[model samples]
Target: MDTIKKYLESMFEHLPKTLEVMRAKDELYSMMEDKYNELISEGKKENEAIGIVISEFGNLDELAEGLGLSKVLDDLVSSDRRYVSRQEADDYVDAVVSRRFMLSLGILLCILSPAGPILLDSIATATGLNLFTGIGVAFLFLCAAVGVGFIVFSNYITKSWSFLNKQPCYIDDETIDYLKSEKEECQTGNGMLLAVGIMLCIVSVIPVIVLDAALNVPIISDGVGPSMMFTLAAVGVFLIVFSSGRNKAYKKLLSLNKKVFAREILQQFADAPDNGPEKSVKIERVTGEVVESDYKDASYSSYDKPEQSSDSTEKKVKNFIKVMVKDYWKSVLCIYIIWSFFTFSWGSSWVIWPLAAILRKPIEQYFLGGKH
Candidate 1:
């Protein structure tokens, strides 16, 4: 009997609580309950009785089809599912604004890390004056350290908002309207930023190629060109990242929108009714008695989210690094080896790793969501 009620609840879970729908649900429950009792009286086991009743009633979709509520059910499914409120949406967008800037700054620093050492080395080679040995090495390591700090800090600050990535929820029309405007502004309003960013990236290495070929001084051309190239590319990427803040927020919202309601790993699991205050679960506690019920008359509700308590911000950063490497390890390795060989500055080549991490999501999303 409990099994039958639970199954019935799940079937109507996403449906609207209209009079017609409620009437249909009550009638179906009555018939199923009668059938189950009849089967039990005939000596059918409890499990066998449940199986028979469920099979006889069939699924909700099949039943709703005759009443022309199939389309209604399909559309209303998301209405009852988890939804994001306006406040939550605003908080997310604001967080992304800061996060994107920090993330871009971190990547920029990483790109500029090798630039310092390369430029210094080039100047030293071109000049007759000798500087302290290992000065360039110290500067290289310093920039790398600062870059790592920014990246890690960005990851830390955004850790609380990571739920927008993995958890699925719906949003009301109002929130949708709000997000649409923000997203459009990000994509269309900042057209110049996007274009300039791409232009900078495309022409970033042009200085190296042009200067290396045109300049008679090999030390100046080869050394200084790479340092300048990284600076230009880093600034370009920073603009791209910063400009896409709202765009990222909107995408995150859509990804979390459970459009087609179905079983998901993080879907709600408690045996809660979709209607009727009287149908709420209640638990009566008896002293020295075992509490066996999964739910009581009144139960608290929340989506199944990852355990965030006691989790350090670095956890996500490390996980992203792993994912970044897993998806783009070969490409990063090839770039590192080739660039190191080309410039003969292995220390400066370390910049590529952070750059790969910063750009992984966009590149992956582009290919994954690209039109075939």
Candidate 2:
């Protein structure tokens, strides 16, 4: 019975949320329930009953046309569909954890970056060599290369976890429910992270002020104060990165589930011609490959009006822009804040806009693809 319900839900998941569709779904559910009960009463086994019920009513194209959702089906079939399996979900989680660890390591390296110059200077001075010469500069570059190597290696490892790139990865109901719950938890975690991060940033300056006034020791006054602040800032950044990574992972799972459900329904009715002969198609089951029928001469243009098309286009463009901004807004904000702090000019911070525009696509593709 649960499997029957889940199958029906998947079939209707891609349909539009219209009142008519909703009513039709309810009717279909009731019909299936009745049929299942009848089959059981007639001495059929539970599995056999479920199979019969689903096979009888699982043609989504027929359901869609009956429920006045032919247009919705058409649009859904045209869009790309994605799928994820239980193994892929586990792999995705591992990849996210690995990436987060790498990010933390990168952050640690950055915080210790000043040590590179200081270490080289100390070594040169101890060896009676000039500390401000070519050797020191070369060592500094070597330190930089090491940091870059860590970043490059992290990226390579992340790309090697290519389960996400494979389409129609199989998944079960338990995985879907787990991912949905995880997504909710991630949202709550993000909120808590923001609150804690802001609190840390604010409290960071307080220690410097209090310690400087209370203690007169040079180490405490000069060194410890700034170091404490840097530590707090680093912690705040860590929280934000952790929260963002988890949130992105959960979102990716949820998005994949939705796409996969839609694709499954599309495939179920792939050869049906209720939408017209042009929309009749075949999908390769093993590869989950879709071969769409050419609809060049299809008279289904009545489903899409010029005004509706324009509005949809505009909405899609807006959504793309919004996603792009959401993905990189933190980096952009950080750049602006850093520039403003150094130059003390908010106007000059505007330079980040053009830089963001130029780098946003590539950065998203390489750095944020997992999240998307």
lDDT string, candidate 2, 49-83, tens digits: 99999898888777767666787678667745434
Query: Model 2 clash pairs?
Result: 85-170
Clash count for each candidate, listed in order shown: 4, 1
> Can you give the lDDT of residue 240 in candidate 1?
70
Model 1 Cα shift for residue 247 (angstroms): 0.8
Encode model 1's per-residue lDDT on 85-145: one tens digit a residue. Answer: 7788888878878877886786677667667767777677777445722576677668656
- Which number leads on TM-score? 1
Model 2 misplaced stretches (Cα beyond 4 Å): 7-31, 40-80, 85-90, 115-147, 152-180, 205-216, 252-372
Query: Which ten contiguous residues of candidate 1 have the minimum total lDDT?
Result: 283-292
Q: Local error of candidate 2 at 42, Å?
A: 4.0
